[model samples]
Target: MSIERIISRQYEIANGISNDIGLPKFKKYAMCNLRGGIGKTTLAFNLSYLTNDLLAVDTCPQGNLSYFFDNQYYSSQAPTVRDLILPYLVPGLGKATRVASYVGATNEYFADKNVYYIPSTEELYLLPSQLITAINQALGLQGAQKEQSLKSILYSLKEEIDREMEQNQLERCLIDTSPFFAGATQLAWYAADALVIPVRTDQQSVKSLELLINTLTSPQSEFRKYLPTNDLKVPQIQMVVLTHCGWSTVSGARNEPNQQTKVYLKKVFDILSRHRTLLSTGDPSNHLFMLDDFLGSGRISSVESKPLSLLHSGETKVIDRVRVSVNKSVDKCKHQLQYINQQLWG
Candidate 1:
């Protein structure tokens, strides 16, 4: 398909993902930047879990949504998001589930559902290499086509989501993506109709935001051709730049935050607005715009939980997610969704 086709197709996919699948009416895009430690995984996990538990009532025997919390989420035979989901994308018995949710207890097909997880594992750390190899294979002299290989992955996700809604009552599919750019980031952006970018009000995140804009707008960037979707409506890009604001510095703090952090934060918001405007195709008044999710102002925070790796606590304490001085981060995430609806559909 042409780049325009790919980009426009995302809107159709969004319609399928939302109303067809029974998800929140407004949500269609996703956030899966390659930046690390920006809580991408956390956001994915939390979103999927919440959507499954809250949005849709009917589930499979294995609970396609529930498996994300478990350690043995994917089978060894089919690793990575593409591996587990690709097989079931086309017409098949369990293709209804769309993504591979879980193997039956006997390692057979699902009892009766079509939802699969893009598994996360230590071995999956090899996904980047696997993706590179696949890309190479795609463009060979007698090539299968690199674009199709990537497009297939997106189809796998959308198809499973659509299928599951057919059989069971599957509303939303929250895909947790690997951190950092590689093939995975491309897949997520291509699949997503919109994107939610959560940024901490720190220097590192601010710098990363500028870099992301360059990547998105670059001529060589793969996402450009697909923008503006089919009718040139929906713009095919939704961004939510959240301030990971909280307070809880440390035991002892010598000084307040530096001026550099503030400058960088403003720059991020400015660029974010401009990016939203571009994404909206300079409509002066278009719904495809960026919003801020600020639970509270900035503050240092503590992290008392273990690493998501679930590494055992040793002599020193491990941090699962950072503890924010603000008690409303969770609420903030929720509130932004409402804003998303207002902006996208209202």
Candidate 2:
């Protein structure tokens, strides 16, 4: 399809949206790892906000990704991912508009970028029992039914957005999950088309990556063992992102990663190479994407200035300087975003 046609289709969905049909199934990817503090949420925020035609779902109780795009959602009583899946759990309770209803628009930096996000809140932590019940109810005698439950709920959420919105414009779904694999995160995995794991260049992160690979690929891994039947499958990992590489100094000198980080990166590279046939990115080098600390610095998003903006309001020179700095940082992330796009659609 031509870009114009694709945009027109997305615009049509956005314009006629009211509770409706699932047009095209958006490519769904779960951004996760078994460990936290690996910049998963931050990466999610950047990818969702910077990229067009993407929907971000925050399943972590932390709600960091929600707050990243707009701090207002932190305390807002808006419905959340937990709310969206609530009805499915309690069979008799009609599915409420919890998740879809709470979807919010991005602010100025990403203004009207054709992006929508389902925020999260601490309240999600208390809903494990409800999720388990819903899972059990959704799962019939077959393991495939278990997986179907995940897809059905998410698809319903997507279709609901299609019906209620100005346009059901979501083309790609980026899900940010908690470290655990049992509850909401597990459901996110089942509903997704692929996985994007963000791992720091550290030994612990490397170990976590190894464990995640096993869980997704090994037949006897915990994920498969717990799925009730042998037929239930997990999404293939799209790629592993390496974040927090050595920071680039103000003087424009880039620091070197520590020896340990180099060792771990090599180890991860080797592991991905060994599993090339199973990975979306066949080459180890292609699968391991790197992001430097400079790109993640807060200079671009500092809140010391106006509340609704990312730019400074000082003199024109100051504003020009800020713009240059921000654009540079954005440019630095282009490769990362491009790689993510390829993994999602390629």
Candidate 3:
């Protein structure tokens, strides 16, 4: 009866991750999207290092994660852990992608770290052409199928990663994606275990998230048709991290808005809630929470930063004569993640 109902749609996603679980569930990627300086890199880098308990791949053109991992800030001045990623990096590639040079990292054992990091280099700027040459060199396979060539290249990379993981029986993967959503972003999403977006609650940034969801859901998108079904579901977006935010006159600004800024941001976040739910992702109750006032809370390490790290949750303390709510929001995130992981594992 409506124009929306006039079209047909279908998606045939593969099942079965190569795990001992014996079912089709394997989490291979953890990609994120948000602009530069939105703490996207921080969330990705720290979470990867923490969760995987090993090296993390920083796959971006700017090489943020990659550089951080290699620099003295992270460890001794060793040949970057990225060297381990060399085997994964291609040789004399097709389509000429500006792939990260595995040039320095020639160690076989270093790549053996539970986590294998693939840093984004300026070479990524030339990746499109590199891919083609890779295939051509493999056996001189080329033709009009050229358009669909990327799919094969991507699948090959995934296979290699999976092979390495299976051979080593590693824990999981943590992949940091590029800033934008197409090109490299597409590759990372297809390989992701889960996604976590860092949301900065300025009016403009909020608008971008709105636009992203709308664009992804729009009819023109390849994934759009599957929106109403489970097939088009986005990989698990574990949580939305809101940063660079300050309380905007909770009591003085027009009746304090009757709702907290964190709460309103939650509504904006829901634009992708369905995708998270479909993938059986999210901790629901606490998955929707706010970062404590950074200034009010004073500098402290994330409790999750260390296993068994404990802190008082839901405590109300007075700061600078202002009875600001601290620890409550953060506690909510911890609790939410705890419950969600339990449910998922069970």
Highest lDDT among the candidates is held by which one?
2
Whole-model lDDT, candidate 1? 0.40
Off by over 4 Å in 1: 1-27, 49-68, 71-82, 85-118, 141-168, 222-235, 246-265, 277-346
By TM-score, the best candidate is: 2
lDDT, model 2? 0.60
lDDT of 3 by residue, 112-203 (tens): 33444545555555554554355455434345354244345444444544554555455566667666654455445555655556666666
Candidate 3 off by > 4 Å: 1-26, 53-55, 72-116, 128-150, 214-219, 222-234, 245-260, 273-287, 293-346
Report lDDT per candidate.
Answer: 0.40, 0.60, 0.43
RMSD of 3: 11.4
> What TM-score, over all chains together, does every model reach?
0.54, 0.71, 0.55
Per-residue lDDT tens digits of candidate 1, residues 1-346? Answer: 1122322322333233312212223334455454566655444433432233112111112223234343344454433344444343233524323333332332222223333343434443454565556545544524334455544543444444445444445444444444455544555555445555666666677667667666667656544442323412222444434344332255553212234433544455456556654453332123222222322211211132111212221223223465444333333334434443434333
Write down the worst ten-residue block by lDDT for model 3: 6-15
**Per-residue C-alpha lDDT of model 2 across residues 146-198, encoded as one tens digit per residue:** 67665555344344434333345556778899987666776777667678888
Number of backbone clashes in candidate 3: 26
RMSD of each: 11.8, 10.0, 11.4
Q: How many residue pairs clash per model?
A: 15, 11, 26
Better of 1 and 2 by TM-score: 2
User: Which window of 10 residues has the lowest lDDT sum in candidate 1?
Assistant: 53-62
